[model samples]
Target: MRSSSPSPAPPVDLAKARRVAVEAAEAAGDLLRAGMARPLEIRPKGTAGDVVTELDLAAEALILRRLRAVYPGHRVIAEESGVNEGTGTAAGADAGLVWLVDPLDGTNNVAIGMPVYAVGLALCAGPVPVLGVVHDPVTRRTWSAVRGEGARGPDGAPLRLAAAARAGRADNPVLAWTQGHEVGRGDPVVLPLRTAVEARCGRLLQLWAPLVAWVMLARGDIDGIVGYRPELVDLPAGALLAKEAGAEFRALDGGPYEPSIDLPPAERGFVAARPALLERLLETTAQACRPAAAGTGSTGGTEGTGGSAGAGGSGGAAQGGRVRLTR
Candidate 1:
C-alpha cells in the first residue's frame, strides 16, 4: 500500500481570533470593574511585595471560560492556572493554539484605588503571538491587535507609534521603566539602568504597570518602555500590541522576544520602542549594566509625576499569582 500524505493545518481566521480575544477580555473587565467597588481581599504570594486579590481569581476564571468556550481544542497558560490542555486533546496536539491570560495586570494599583490596572490577553500559535487584547475597565478602553492587521483603539481607530526618527531625539522624550517586584536597589542591573535612562531621556516615569505603559506607547503618549525581569504573563499581550502598532521589540541583549510558553522569565529584561530609538535604547541599557561610575548614586531622581510603589503604586510582580483552575 502507498504511504498516505500528511494533512495540512487548518486555516486560522485572525479577524475572528481578534474578536474573541476582545470579547473575553471585556468580559473579564466587567468582573474586575465590579470587584473594584468592594473592599479588596489581598494577600502576599512568593514575597511580601508580590500580591493577589479575590478579583484576580474571579476575572481569570471568566477569561478562561470564555476562551475555552470559543476555542474548544486550544491550550491555555494563564497567570493563575499554570497550564491546561484543551478538552479531550493531547498536550502536544493543542500546542499550536495557546491563550495567555493575565486577568489583573496590576493588583497593587487596584488595591490602592489607582485606576492603572487592566486585563491583558494574548493568543499565540506555536511560538508566535498572533492576537492581543488589553482592556482597561476604568477607562472603558479596549486595545486589540492581530499580527499584520495593525493595532486598534477602543473606538476602532488605527493606532500608530510616533515616528522613529523623532523618537530618537533627546528633546523632552518621556521613557518608562519597571523593575521586578522582588528586585531590590542593590541589583547591579536595576540601579545603573535606571540611572542611564534618567540621564539620557528628558523625563523618566516609573509605572509598575506594564500594560498601561504599553498602551501609552501605542497611543503615542509615551516615547518608549523598558521592563526588567518581566514575567511571562506581563510580556505577551503588550509585546504583540507594540509590534502591531509599529514599535520595535527585543530582548535587552538585542535578540527577538520569543513568545514561547516554555521560556523562563527574562533575565536581561525587554525593550520596546520606535524603530529608530531601539538601537540607542539598547546601547544605553547595555552600558548601564557595566560597572557604575565612582560617584554614581542609585537615586535617578523623582523628576516625573507618578505615585511611587510605596504609595499604592506597583511596578509589576515577579511571580504569577493567579489561582489555577484545572479543567
Candidate 2:
C-alpha cells in the first residue's frame, strides 16, 4: 500500500521570529562592541587571511544562548561551532525550524579596527527565511525584515528599493563586491564577473563584510551587491533583507537562488541588484562566464522563484561552470 504524504509544519509566527532574531542580534552586537574596545588576540583559521579571535567565539556563544532560551528544540547552524541538533529531537519534527547565525561577519575588518562589522541572524522554516536581523554595533544601526511584513531600518522606517531608484542616480549606481579570501581562489566565476560589473557600474566597492553590504543595499546606500563562496551564517540574513527591500536576487548565470541549509558551500554566491539594473547586471555576469567562442545569447531572462538546478559537489567551483546563489 502507498503511504500518505507527511503533514505540513505549523505556520510560523513571523513577528515573534523577528523579535527573537532581533534580540539575538542586538545582544551579540553589544558583546562584539564591548569586546572590540580591548586588544584581541587574533589567530588564523583555515587560511592565512581567514582569522578568528576570542571575541568571535564569545559572541557566538552569547547568540546561541539567546536563541536556545527561546527555541531549545530548533536546529542551529553557526560559524564558529558547526551544527547543533538541539534537544536531540527527531529530525523530521525539527526539520521545519532552523537558525542561521553569523556572530562576526567581518572578523578581519574588526581586527584591524576598520569599524565595519555586524551580527546577523535568520530564522528559517525549512529553506525559506521567515525573519532576519543584522545589527552594526559601531554605528548602532539595525536592519530587519519579516517575510511578508517588509524590511525596516533602525529607526523603524519601512525600507523600499524604489527609494534609491527614484533618487535620479541610477546612472551612478554603486555595486559592492566581496573581497573575501574565498572569492578569487575558490570561485572562478567571481573575478571575471567582478571585472564586468566594475566596467558596467559607475563604481565598485570591495567589502570583506557581507552583512554590511546587504544592509547598505537595503538602506539604498548602495545599488547592488555580489558575493561568492559566502559562509552559511553570512548570507541568510542579508538575502532576506534584500528580498524584503525589493532587491532582485539571482545566480550569476541569471537563475533563481534556492536558499537552503543543505546547499553545498560551492553554491553560495549571488547577485543582488535593483530591479531595473538586475537584467543588465545578470546579462553582463553571464557574458563573463560564457566561453569566448560561444557568442552571447539571451541571458535566460527568467524571474527567479528561489529554485535552480543543483550544484555539482562541495568543491571550489560548481560543475559545468554554472553559477549558484547562497543561503
In TM-score terms, which candidate is top? 2
Residues 61-122 of candidate 1 have per-residue lDDT tens digits of: 88888877777778777766667678765444554777778888878777778777888888
User: Residue 221 in model 2: shift from native, Å?
Assistant: 0.7
- The CA lDDT at 51 in model 2 is 69
For model 2, how does the per-residue alpha-carbon lDDT over 1-327 read when each residue is reduced to its tens digit?
000123224355667777877878888888889888899998876532466789888988998898788777777877777666667444446556778777887887777888878888887777667678999989878899877668898988988777446365577678887533443333445456668888988878766677888888887788888665455566678878887888887776778775444554445557788888888888887677664214323222211211111110011111112222222
For candidate 1, what is the lDDT? 0.67
Please report, in order, the local distance difference test score of every candidate based on alpha carbons.
Answer: 0.67, 0.67
Error of 2 at 277 (Å): 0.9
TM-score of each: 0.81, 0.82
Which stretches of model 2 miss by more than 4 angstroms?
1-11, 88-92, 163-168, 183-187, 292-327
